[model samples]
Target: MQILLLGGHGKVALHLTPLLLKRGWNVTSVIRNPDHESEILALGKGLKGNLNVLLSSLADVKSAADAQKIIDTVSPDYVVWSAGAGGKGGPSATIAIDQEAAKHFMTASFASPGVSKFLMVSYLGSRKKQPSWMSDSEWAGVVKVNTEILPTYAKAKQEADEYLTALAEVRKRDPNASRFQAINLRPGTLTDEPATRMVDLGITPKGRGSVTREDVAIVADLLLARSDTEGWIDLVNGEEGVEGAVERVAREKVDAVVGEDVEGMVKRFFPEAGLKF
Candidate 1:
């Protein structure tokens, strides 16, 4: 498959690009500078020829148009956005990259009549919750860094997901809507370890187990192979020799839990299969 990797220099994309190459998929890595462009190429090492590198600032105004042009030119089978801008100015930067950039890229790709799929990565826990990031005080870095503005990275992600969902719905209503399918993969606190595959790392204040970048890539590739996928879905690594039961639930079950229940569930499953959102 022909694929585009947005923010291709990010850690996840670093691992993601190589794995995609192993699956025999051609990749176009997008970055902000020529130096970053060369660095990624160098990292490809032996897998060199399988990758195409591009340089552009997704934070700029023209990014949307430029991104759209690239999409039209390559006409990729899939687009993976694994880039993130966090810390201090992270809120503003994230708003531009995660939300504006996401919209531009999604609109650019999905707006076409023949585009295949749009897969993005977002945080898992807050998918269904409001931007309680500032309120919680638990996720202290985001708010304190920006101080007055209280950068809302979580809110940016949430808004972006909602926008894509709406766009997909609108596309379906029109008989001649775009053919592209979109799905957001919301993985838990990402880790570099390959050992924790398919397990949910209790996403809480204290944090829990870790989900590796390799695992998230596995889920993204799976969705890209299919034409039908949507909304926000959770993907994690399940432990070996541990065939535990993990089921999907309705929104009602989420609302059924009390505040304390959340903490208890989080602590209990932190060491086990991980907690549920």
Candidate 2:
């Protein structure tokens, strides 16, 4: 299989690319600097396979053409968008690179022949305003959780998530359209430890689980391997001492804070009754 990675220079992508190479997958990394072209090529030769890099940058939305060009050449089986610069930025910079650039990548994936998998690195708090995630002041906490790059990054991720969800639904209705499978892989906090087991996705992280980049590589493999139609998969890392994982821990934390969805938290707080959304 061929995988085209955007922001291959990213921390997580660095680990993921090598993992894919080991699995005999061809990789074409997209980056803004032509300088990175040689870097990924060298990394590929080190791993042993046809690893290529295309020059592109997500910083400027106008350069979206660069992304399209790379997509045209690679025609990969999966397109992973890890494209973003980390650091403090206001909402404007956030939306430019995070939201709009993401849109460009997804659009290109749709255009790619035979490409069906579109995976993105997203956070859990992305949908706090929606009934599906939470209600009340819980939203403020969610905001902090998702806003790794602060408000700007959070806004961008939120917009991108909603947009992709809508796009997936449209395709689901149109069978003639490509049968695309998109997933948001949510890891608590990125770490650097090597993966020793399959991800514990059944539970939320136990107190902000931090996963190593190696662990991220494992989760990415699981994500790319699964062919789930359209849904969100939260792979919160960390264990409660021996047995329980984050998901199990989440039930306790959420229940302690405001209780479960069974308590009518959805209707009581952010009611969808009056407004036609």
Candidate 3:
């Protein structure tokens, strides 16, 4: 499979690239800086796959022309949105990288004939409705999650996730004719701890929790390989080991195999996840 990744230097993307490479998949990473090229290369040093770099800034992808340029440059089977402003950049920066960039990528995917799937690396609170207790001004303010603004981050993600889910609805209604499919992955608070190789996949975990960045990458890897998989799913540290979760996910037969409706399709593919339109 040919995969294109945004945010090439990100912690999760760095881990994901090597895993995809080990599976012998052709990978193209769109990176803003040339300096990070070596790190990506180093990951694939002894791996079996080919790594290609496309130098482009996600923030600069604002127009159809920009979208077309990306489509033509990297004819990808799957596009992974892993890029973000890392919360250091203020709200404008977050809107640019997280919302606008993600929208442009979806547009670019539609324009690209080779692209089939779009995977979003979202967050735990992304789908939450704006709470009645929090006023607009208060919600928009920088409420920190660690050093990042929790509300701003969640709002940005919510907008992006909503847009993709809308597109997914249109695709599902006309699966054979739809241009591409999509899946939004919302993982809980992230930590830099080493790969746990275990995760809880659902709408929300048993409770609010955190997960290792590496474990999220592993889930992404499995989801990418399952073409029939679509829509949103949340990830967190859980009782099931990563290997077992992956096996269970892989074993679930999709609609093509079972002659089922869309709801059944989603339930079988992501039994633990909450279903959206």
TM-score of each: 0.70, 0.75, 0.80
Candidate 1 C-alpha lDDT tens digits along 38-108? 77887566763378897766777345576778787667778888876754355677788777888788777
Which ranges in model 3 have alpha carbons more than 4 Å from their true place? 130-149, 175-179, 247-277
- Comparison by TM-score, 1 against 2, better one: 2
Minimal lDDT window, size 10, model 2: 254-263
Error of 1 at 68 (Å): 1.3
lDDT per residue (tens digit) for residues 1-277 in model 2: 8898888887788878877887788988877777666667767766754688877667765444655776777878999987776653556667777888887777677666678889888765555443333444555556566655367677777667666665555556564676788766666667666664545453343324556666666667656765642345455554432123333333343221122232243244224443221
Reference-based lDDT, each prediction: 0.61, 0.63, 0.73
On the 0 to 100 scale, the lDDT of residue 126 in model 2 is: 56
Model 1 residue pairs with clashes: 197-237, 197-238, 198-236, 198-237, 198-238, 199-237, 199-238
Off by over 4 Å in 2: 34-39, 46-48, 63-66, 88-91, 130-140, 145-149, 196-198, 202-207, 239-277
Residue-level error in angstroms, candidate 3, position 167: 0.5
Q: What does the lDDT read for residue 28 in candidate 3?
A: 92
Local lDDT at 244 for model 3 = 68
